[model samples]
Target chain A: MSEFTRGFRAGIPIGIGYLSVSFTFGIMAVSYGFSWWQAVIISMLTLTSAGQLAGISVMVHPGQYLEMLFSQLTINIRYSFMSVSLSQKVAASFSGMKRWLLGFFMTDEIFAVASAEKTVDAKFFFGLSVAPYFGWALGTLGGSVLGNILPEVLMNSLCLAIYGMFLAIIAPKARTSRAVLCVTVVAILLHVMFVYLPILNRVSSGIAVSVCAIVAALIGAWLFPHDEEENEA
Target chain B: MREFFIYLVILVGSTYLVRALPFALMRKKIKNRFIRSFLYYIPYTVLAAMTFPAAVLATGNMLAASLGLIAGGVLALQGKGLTLVAFVCCALSLMTDLIMITLN
Candidate 1:
C-alpha cells in the first residue's frame, strides 16, 4: 500500500531468495578451491548468480577462460535488454551517479518489479534493491564459511531452490495475462520440440530457447498490440 | 599469485565493460523501433534459454526432466513465482537423482 510497506514486502522475498542462492554460490566457489574471501568478493561484485556459477569452471581451468568469458557474456547479456526496458521507468533527472549505481544492480528481478510499478521513481527502486543486494553478499560469505558443515543431501536440496524461485516470478504474471500464458506455453512447447529433435541437438539449449522465445514474442506482439491504457504502469 | 591477480583484473574489467558502457552512453531515450522490439522479446528468450537446459537437463534422464517439467509447469500454472517454481522443480529432480543413485 504505502511505499514503505510496498518496499518492505517486495524486499523481503528478494532478501531471502538471494540469501539461499548466494550461499549456494559460495559453497560452489569453496568447493572449487577458491578462497572464502574470493568467493565473497565475487558474489558481492558480480551480484549475478549465473555469472558467478560459470566463473567457477573458468577459475578452475585457466585455459578455458576465453570460452567461459564468452558463455557468461551470452547468458548475462540479457541484462542489457532489461536495462533498456528500465530506461523509461528510471527518473529522467536521476543524477549521473545514481544512474551508474543503479545500473550496477540492474538485475532481472529488480527490473521486473521496478518496471511493473505504478510510479517510476528512482528512490523506490533503490529501496527495493538494497535488501536483495545485502542478502546476496551476506549469503555468499556465510555459505562459504559454513562449507561442508551441512549434509550433502540438505545442501543439494537447497541448490535446487533456484528453479523454484524462477517459477514464482513468472507464474503470477502468466495467470493475469493471456498473452503471457500463450507466450510461456509456446516457449515450453518449442523447448520440448527442440530438445527432442535430432537435427537441433547440435545447438545448445540456451541458444534454442532464445531463438524460440524471440520468435514467439514477435508473433505475440503483432497479434495483440499493446493498448495505451495497458502500457501505463 | 600474479596469475590470480591477472584473472581478477580481467574478470572485473570485462564485467564492468559489459555493464557500465551502455548506461553511460545510452542516455537518449531508446527511440529505435527495431531496438525496442529486440528488447521486448529478449527477456523471454533469455528466460526460456536459461530455464530449460539448466534445470531440465541437470538430471541427465528423461524421467527426471519430465518430473521437473511437470513440477515446474504445475507451479507455473498455479501462479507461483519463477524463482520458487524453478527452485522446487530443480530440487525435486535433484532429489530424485539422489534417490535413484542410492537405490541403484
Candidate 2:
C-alpha cells in the first residue's frame, strides 16, 4: 500500500474517536449562544478539544483578548513538545513549508500515530490529517444542528472514547517495555497528585499535564536510557 | 460578533504558533542520548497523564468510567486495535450507566 494510504487507513480510528468529542464541543458552542456556523468555523480553525472549549468559556464571559491568547497558549502548550518530538521523526523531505503545514494538523492522536511510524513524510502526515480534520468539522456541524438529541447517558459514555484511544496507544508498548511501564506509572501518579492535592490542584490542567509528563519522562530517561541504535532500528 | 471574531483570531493564532514554531525551527535532530530517549518517552508519558484521573471523571459516574477504563486497558493489552478498544469502552460505559438507571 502507498504510504499516504497507509497513514489514512491508520487515521480512521482517530477520526471516528473525534466525532464524539467534537460533537460535544459543537453542542457547547451553540449553547453558549454561538450560531451553528460559528461553532463549525471554530472547530475548523482551532481543531482542538480543550483549547476550543476553554476558548468558548472565555468568549462567553467578559474576558479580555489577552485572556483568550494566554489561555490558549497555556492550554495548548503540550503541542509544542509533541511537535518538537515529532520533528525528529519526520522524513528529511519534510522541511520548511511542509513542516509548518504538518504542524497545523498535529493533534494528540495524530501525533501519537505519526510518531509510532518508522518514518513520516509530508504526504503521509497530510493524508493522516484528512480524516480527523473532516471528522472534527463534520461532527461539530452535526452536533450544532442536531443539538443534544442523543441521550445524555450515551453522550457521557462517548466521552470515554478518547481516553480509550489513549490507552490503546500506550498499553501495548507499556506491556513490552519496562521503561515505558515505569514512565506510564509515574506519570499517572503525578497526575493523580496534581488532581487531588490542595494547592497543586490549583495549577491549570495544561501546565499540570506538561509538568507531569516531562518529569516522568526525565526519570525514565535517566533510569533506562535506550541504545541509539535501538531507536533508529 | 466582531469581538468574537477577534477572540477567535487570537485563539487560533496562539494555538497554531504553539504547534508550529518548534516543529518549524527544530530542523536538526538532537543526537544527545538523554534527550532522544526523553523524546521517545514523551508520547507515552503525556498520554498516560492525560488519560487517568481525567478518564475517571469522563463519564460523570466514577463506577462506569472505571469499568470502561478497565475494559479498554485489557483489550489494548491484548493487542486490540484502537477502534475496537474505544468503541468497546463507550459501549461498556453506556451499558453500565443504563444498568444503574434501571436499578435506580
Candidate 3:
C-alpha cells in the first residue's frame, strides 16, 4: 500500500473521535442561536475544538472582538509549535503553501500520530487529514441538523469520549518516558493552579492553558535534555 | 447573528494565522538543541493540560467525572488501545452519572 493509504487508514479512528466532539459542538451552536449552516461553516473553516467552543461562548454573549481573538489565538497556539516540529519532518521539497495547508489540519489527535513518525510525506499528511476533516464536518452537520433530538444520557456519555481519546493518546507516552511523565505532572499542576486562582480563572482559559503548557515544557527541556537518538528511538 | 458571522471571519482568520505561522517561518528543520527538545515535549504537556480538570466534568457531576478520569487513566496505563479505553470510560462515567442522579 502507498504511504498515503497507510496514513488514511490510520486516520479512521481519529475521524471517529473528532465526530463525537464536533457533534457536541454542533449541538452547542444551535443552542447558542447559531444556525446549522453557521455551525457547519465554523467546523469547515476552523477545525480546532477548544477554539470553536470559546468563540461560540463569545457569540452567545456578544463579547468584544479582541476577547474572541485573544482567546482563540491562545487556545490554538499549540498548533504553531506542533507545525514547527512537523515542518522538519515533512518532505524538504514542499513549498510554503503546502506547509500552510498541512498546518490547517494539525489538530491534537492528528498531531499525535503524525509527529510520532521519523519522517512525514506530504501525501501521507493529506491522507491523514482528509478523513478526520470529513468526520468533523459531517458530524457537525448531523448534530446541528439533529440538535435537541437525542436523549440526554447518550449525549452526556459521548461528550467525554473525546477527552478519553486525549487521555489514551498521552497516557502511553507518560508511562514510557520519565521526562514525559514529569512534563505531564507539571502541566497538570499548573492548570489546576490556574483554575483555582480567582482572578486568573476569569482570564481566557486558552491563555491560561497556553501559559501552563509552555512553562511545563520549558522546565522539561531544561531538566531533562535528550539526545537526537532518543528523539527518533 | 451578524456578530456571530463577523466573528467567524475573525476567529477563522486569527486561528489559521496562529496555526500557520510557525510552519511558514520555520521552513528548515530546527537545529537548536534546547528548542528542539522543547518542541518535542510540547505535545505531551499540552495534551495533559487539556485533559485533566476538564475531564473531571465529563459525567455531568464532579464525582462521576473524577471516577471516569481515574478509570480512564488506569486503563490507559495498562497500555490499552484508544478505542477500548475511551469506551470503557464512557460507560463507567455514564453509569456513575446515572447512579448519582437517581440518588439525588
Best by DockQ: 2
lDDT per residue (tens digit) for residues A93-158 in model 1: 654777677677777777767778865566776778888899999989888888778765555555
Provide the lDDT at A118 for model 1: 60
In candidate 3, which residue pairs clash?
none
DockQ preference between candidates 1 and 3, better one: 3
- Please rank every candidate by lDDT, starting with the best: 2, 3, 1
Q: How far out, in Å, is residue A182 in model 1?
A: 8.8
What lDDT tens digits, residue by residue, belong to model 3 across residues A1-233?
Answer: 99889999989988887777677678768867888999999999999876787677676666578767766665676677677767777777665777777778888778878878878887888899989999999989988888778767756766666677668778888898999899999999999888888887886666666778889989998999855643221
Model 1: iRMSD?
4.3
Sorted by TM-score (best first), the order is: 3, 2, 1
Separately for all candidates shown, the number of backbone clashes (residues 3 or more apart, or on different chains) is 25, 0, 0
Candidate 1: segments with Cα more than 4 A from true spot: A1-9, A169-233, B1-11, B57-69, B90-104
Model 2 has an lDDT value of 0.82
Model 1 DockQ reads 0.36
Q: Give the distance in Å from residue B10's predicted Cα in candidate 1 to where it truly belongs.
A: 4.3
